[model samples]
Target: METAFADYLDEFTRRDWETLDPEAVADPVRVAVVGLGWFAREWALPGIARSAYTEATVVTDVDPDAVETVAAERDVTGVTPEEFRSGAAADAYDAAYVATPNAAHLDYVRAAAAQGKAVLCEKPLEATLDRARRLVAACRDADVRLMVGYRMQTDPAVRRLRDLLRAGVAGDVVHVHATMSQTMLGELGGDTDQWRLDPELSGGCALMDLGVYPLNTTRFVLDEDPVRVSGRTRTRHEAFADVDEHASFRLAFPDGVDALCTVSQNAQHASRLEVTGTEARLISDPAFYEREDRGFAVVRDGTRVDVDFDQVHQIEEEFAYFGHQLLADEPFHPDGEHALADMRALDGIYRSAETGRSVTLDEDAA
Candidate 1:
């Protein structure tokens, strides 16, 4: 049980994945999937199915046929949006996962809060800053737990990286450069007419859909909100004329920490995060993605230590964490307030992009 100095210096990461493991219990949390969209049907539903602390009990959608299809496939109750809005089938599940578009999230969140059910809504909170504030308030007023679905916060590797950084492995992080991009239309078989391309539905294009990964992840790892932000965006394709096809933002944080994050929907796939510090540097390739193999490395004094973490279903980790925390009557990190701050930052980004000026953020954008 004795430890070597080399072992301590080279590889001494603590395990931080207890939430991902299955919990011993007589009953797991029951969940409802609202919005049978592509993400819900193909990604979120599968993630829920794989969760150890939760199980899907009801599937709801605006489209009756899609709801019925997913319900039959998963052997769960199918509730129409109208039915769900009216509080029908409310007893089927203890929590609701709202996967609807940005603007539509409030309705489902309000409805879930009204029924005294816990909620796990997808990130960005809502399409607009005002709506996001109201969404958080709705949950607050009802005294319901509103966990935002930010899966990167639940990644084991990311947590370990955060641990190392916090332990001074990378001393005094000064700057970060992160980028996440993928071809979502014209080349990736993504529907050209999807809601993502619609400015109203998706809020923004590349920034809202993809850029939030870097913004929120950086915020999570640093645990520091940005003091100010500057943003720029580009639109080339007709499908994204009203929104950004490529966007970039520079965030200035406390303690002299700063980050420049970029995202695009027309670029070759890339998800990378590079951190710089006074003593060392850390880099994570394929960082934003959970399904892909991640390459994480720490370099100190011209020496590099690399780790290839085992692939994990990040979506499952998020749901499991939510269910476990909700069952234990504990507060989760990525709750409604946390999401509201992200919305605040995002709103600043948009304002900066439009005004061609750096926007200062409120310290307590509550």
Candidate 2:
């Protein structure tokens, strides 16, 4: 009998890369996480440390106290931003997780690539497509593997949906509707200096923060690039004056399939995806970033087929997958090309929102 990890490895190999034994690698990958914020401290650091093929060696942040506290809590060493800038601090780790703000992703990624270390960057890749392309090229030139932190790709429920879609269990996908919204983030406005509300850091509000989930998930599940896009966006809160607080978009695939997605910072709660097909419809509950009891239902002929998944920490799954890839010498999932495509889609969304016209990807762009 094969374990879930073995099945995951096999699936990744069958879909994306060649096979390799995850157990054969000699050294545990030493990793440093470059942010001591909520995400790094609460999720990523612990997950990586718990992974079998990786060890959390160091943490860095501009706030010394924050870094020190996370390090003390996680039992890892700490490095100041000044030490990181001097290039003396990052040498101890074989790789780095750039969990910084959206705009800073490229710079941190480039720094790690320059040091010939693999990098796992938090999403949005960069605030712009040009920067993302450059980062991808730099990583390739430096022979460093780069992966985006699109943890949904490693999620078991999402994986199951992908399988169903690919296997034609949801036959001939015609339309997809995805919604992601939350009031929690907007209410917890702490520092006006926090990067998320700043256009220079968070990129473009709800779209960059939450829209990326549906956009990425739609592309992943359908295995198709959007051919054209049109969008409408608004900034509802004064705190996000520099960025949008709500956004909705329509995407058309080459095969006539359409996707309608909405993201908002002021909504009451979260919603998920509804995938409609010729034969059946599939519905996912609170689809994005679900950590516990995450599951889906398949509806065919007005009957519901229920599916249940064990409650697993998505961050843990993500770290474990990354570890397995590194140890097995397997190709990184959500590699540079995937990141580039996602950026292209996002660029289209922004353009469409501003121009109030449909934006189409050039053949070369895809």
Candidate 3:
């Protein structure tokens, strides 16, 4: 058996990925995609389409026309939400990818788990902390693997950053600063029915959507949970009156390690994660994109070492890891517990922002 990290050995500068061979597992996983929306249609499907370790067996959506459109292009069976919940569909796939909205993740995940299919869900796990915990419990009780769709966990550059931190190359982590910003309506060109503005559907605003990148990245790099959080959220424009347009939060982890993160729906353009330690600093600009290539840098004692990574399709990496977990019974890196921890911290952040006070967290609660 090959080591799990063998493929990533030359990921930093590898440009010949087209010639790279596919994985040799016992059986490729058959995945039923539960949503046919923008993210599922664009980013996720392309990766799943490429991976030899996974196949999109069926597509599910409330809108049959949308499902049929995606099905025709992807060459997968299209099913309505009702048929997807039936027993016949349950037995068709080894795993289900929950690409639905943040708020609806719980029901879909629970249903998939109950049918004894492994689940890979998009970030946040659920819209809120309570549901997140329940989803985790449901999966656990069903004895099925539950993984969060966190591409950064498998991203080459991000993995290099984590490796450096773990190897103490940065020397005693002290602080981290991250930012992810985008003009949602501008980029999406969608109307208000986008479901992101509704508190009941999307949960929170920028923090719940784009903020997860920084939130999950900081935690992944540090490998530590936050003990306290303080945040502030605002509705910068009348268009965002029902939800927050901007949010900034501070996290206090054990050993005095602190992190600052900002997420915004009204910003020009910003995506970065910077880690500063006693000895050096590591930075990743455009930290959370699905592009095929990106660059990062390491700075120490006035010397800079820039590293450029090629073939950065994190979604493929995510699917590969999920397939490994299914075939080898390997642990999912950012497992359900990993997501629940982040949801708990986000819950604290939202409460702190609303009350204008620091929210302390108990390690035992999560």
Question: What is each predicted model's overall lDDT from 0 to 1?
Answer: 0.84, 0.79, 0.82
RMSD of each: 2.7, 4.1, 4.1
Candidate 2 residue 304 C-alpha distance from true site, Å: 1.0
lDDT of 1 at 132: 90
Expressed as tens digits, the lDDT of each residue in 102-192 for candidate 2 is: 8777777888888888888888888778888888888999999988889888876677777777777777999999998877364444455
Output the lDDT of residue 220, model 2. 86
Q: Write the residue-wise lDDT of candidate 1 on 1-366 in tens digits.
A: 012213333432333445434647557789999998877887788888787788999999888999889999999999888888788889899999999888899999999999999999998789888889899999999998899999888876677667667777777898999999888875446688777888898899898988889998999888888889999999998878888999999999998799999999998989999888887887888798755777788788898878754667778778878877876777888988888778888889989989999989994554
TM-score of candidate 3 relative to the true fold: 0.93
* For model 3, the run of ten residues with the poorest summed lDDT: 1-10
- Best candidate, TM-score: 1
Considering every candidate listed, which one attains the maximal lDDT? 1
lDDT winner between 1 and 2, please give it: 1
Worst 10 residues of 2 by lDDT: 9-18
Across 151-254, the per-residue lDDT of candidate 3 in tens digits comes to 88777777778777777778899899999888877877746677789888788889999888898988888888888999999887777788889999999999
Error of 1 at 222 (Å): 0.8
Model 3 misplaced regions, further than 4 Å: 1-23, 363-366
